[model samples]
Target chain A: MKIIITVVGNDKVGIVAAVSQKLSELQVNIIDMSQTLMHGSFTMMLMGELNAEADFASIKKELSTVGEQIGVSIHVENQELFDAMQNI
Target chain B: METKQIRDTIAMIDEQHLDIRTITMGISLLDCIDSDSHKACEKIYDKITRCAENLVPVAEELENEYGVPIVNKRITVTPISLIAAAATDTDSYVEYAVTMERAAASLGVDLIGGFSALVQKGYQSGDRKLIASIPDALMATSRVCSSVNVGSTKTGINMDAVAEVGEMVKALADKSPLKCMNFVAFANAVEDNPFMAGGFHGVGEADCVINVGISGPGVVKRALEKVRGKSFDIVSETIKKTAFKVTRIGQLIGTQASERLNVPFGIVDLSLAPTPAPGDSVAEILEEIGLESVGAPGTTAGLAMLNDAVKKGGIMACEHVGGLSGAFIPVSEDAGMIKAAENGNLNIEKLEAMTAVCSVGLDMIAVPGKTTASTISAILADEAAIGVINNKTTAIRVIPVPGKDVGEEIDFGGLFGRAPIMRVNQSSPAAFIGRGGHIPAPIHSFKN
Candidate 1:
């Protein structure tokens, strides 16, 4: 299954690096990435292909921990939700 | 993969309360009927538990898998009256309700509906028995919701049944006003409704089906805010676009849940169901459409536009749309409506008028305990007239809180919310309600 991880908070160095490292460690492959700075607040969206054996709950918890350490808010959601709401 | 679309979807879920309101499994209990009441009750329990064992888990899995919250997992069965009719030994159908409550509790479902009877024209023996047992049944069971269809477009209104249910509602409240919250009286009740306390598996439905009800009052309100001060055309267009997105999500979730449960997918009820939570209110949506408040003048016109636009936008998004497919105005369940009522801007009379243009009528309203059954019957008659003449679905789920007066409030907690006991007109309608006969179908019902 694919999931979208959105990060939004104050702009800081290595925001993408921190999030990407956490995903890689969990064996989740990055499929797409987008980053923008809006009024000095950093926003990034990462699409990742989750491994079959990975624990979704643990991965989400670990990502939130990483996000907290880096001063950002992280949200993980299935891509189908966005596709369903927008494509139709 | 567009950033804008992703952000929009996220905002809808995270900020606006876009949610699949309920995923109700309708299970027909015709085959469970037996001559012996005890055996019938056993079969009923077995059938419900066996069919709905996986409903909660499956709904939760879908909620996690699709990243959209499914607020309620519920069950609706063939109206217990039909099943109880076969049991010659029983004078009451309270056992049927008890068995349903057990099944619901065992399955971890939020509520189980269809403890109901349809007597739009007149009552049968079974309907009479079921109606007689409602007060006790509802008072005894926590999760078993009940409804009675006392009127319809083709058959007119069953004034006798309406009168009985009005007294039944009072009796229910006298036992426990909260129990009245679980009961509804409907005009033109739909068979596949996923919303409660009015959902039931109609006699015409399949043995088992899955129906989805979607909710997004917050999304519509937010969209209307964006078009603030715009013309009606822009406002309507914005609402339609937002409703399309909400219904599409409902369809997606419904299809996925049906496939997982291996149940036939029924209709998607595209209702903007509201909660007491901030920002998730149908009244707020109405206010956003240029009304000063939900019950203020021009509210009916605003609601009519919203109801029509939602149907227009949602019809294309799903294969089938049924249930009460419009904006619901349940006062206690909506923060804005509750506030409007508290501030004296919204009253029972205005709400009765609003029902002609909205989805349901006098929903989740609270009246003083001193209110008489005849007055309640009069209210039902008025609402039923609106639905019957207009050929729409209208219902009443008013609670007459026992020992509570006009200024007092009843806190049902959770999604049932808190209700301020609004004053009812003291004028007696005893003579009108006591004339118990069928209100004949309207002239417009001759569509042929």
Candidate 2:
């Protein structure tokens, strides 16, 4: 299943590198990525595919830990929900 | 993958309180009927437990999978009056309620509906028995909800049933007045409603179906806040777009749940049901749409537009839409409404007027215990009249807290919330209600 991971916090270096590293560690492939700085605050949204072996809950916890280490707020959600709510 | 879409959806859930209100599995209990009451009760219990065994787990799984909060998991069986008609050993239908309660507890459902009777035209033996058992049944069970349809557009109002239910509501209040919260008096009640205490699997519905009720008053309110001071057309358009997003999520959840459970998908009830939590209020939506408060002069017009826009937006998102598809203004369940009522900005009379446009009528209202049963019946009649005249569904679920008077509050706790005992007009409608005969169907209903 595909999921969307969003990170929003102060602009800083290594935010994308850290998130992508965490995703690669879990064997989840980043399918899409977007990031921008708005009024000195950094916002990034990434759509990733979770392989069969990856546990969704653990990935969420580990990513939150990474977010804490980077001083950002991370949210993960199933991609289908966004498609359902926005496409129609 | 649009980042804006992802962020907006997240904001709707995390900030605006967007959630699927209920996923009710409607299980028809018609086949459980038996001549022997004990055997029938056993059959009823066994069938419900078996059919609903995985409802909670499946709903929770969907909640996690979809990343949307499914607030309630409930079961609505065929109206117990119809199922109890075949029982020969017992005249009282309280045991059926007990059986339903047991099934709900075993399955871990939040509430089990259909402890109900449809006596809109008249009463059968089972209907009478079930009506009589309502007070005791509701008082005894914690999770069982009940409803009675005492009027309809086609059949008019069954004044006799209305009169009886008035006394029944009072009796329910007399014994643990909070039990009155579990009972709904309806006019033109629908079968596919997933919201309790009005939900029931109509005899005409399929044996098993999954009906979903979607709630997003906060989302709508937030959208309106963006268009503040904008024209009505802009406001309406914003509401429609927001409702579309909300209902689409509901369709997704409902379809997935039905597929997983192997039950046919029922309709999605696009009701903007409110919660006691701030920012999750239908009345606040109205206020955002330029009303000073919910019960202010323009409230009805605001609610009417909101209700219509929601339906127009939701109809395109779901395959089927049923139940009371409009903004609900239950005082106790809505923080804005409760605040308005406490401050004397909203009252029962204005609420009665609002029901002509709102989805349901006089819902979750608390009245003084000293209020007479006849007065409660009169209130029901008034609300039913609005539904019948307008050809819409309206209902009453008022509680008359025992030994509590106006200005006092009854705390039901949790989702039921707290309600202040609002004053009821002391005028008597006993003469009209005492004349127990059917109120003839309106002229519009005669379009044959």
Error of 1 at B173 (Å): 1.0
Provide the clash count, candidate 1.
0
* Candidate that would win on DockQ: 2
> How is the predicted docking of candidate 2 categorized under the CAPRI scheme?
medium
CAPRI-style docking class of model 1 based on DockQ: medium
Give a tens-digit lDDT track for model 2, residues A1-88: 8999999999888999999998988888998989998678899999899988777777888998999999999998888899888895
Clash counts for all predictions: 0, 0
Candidates in order, TM-scores: namely 0.97, 0.97
**Native-to-model Cα distance after best TM-score fit, residue B259 in candidate 1, in Å:** 1.0
Lowest-sum lDDT 10-residue window in model 1 chain B:
B60-69
Give candidate 2 misplaced runs (Cα > 4 Å).
Answer: A52-54
Residue clash pairs of candidate 1: none
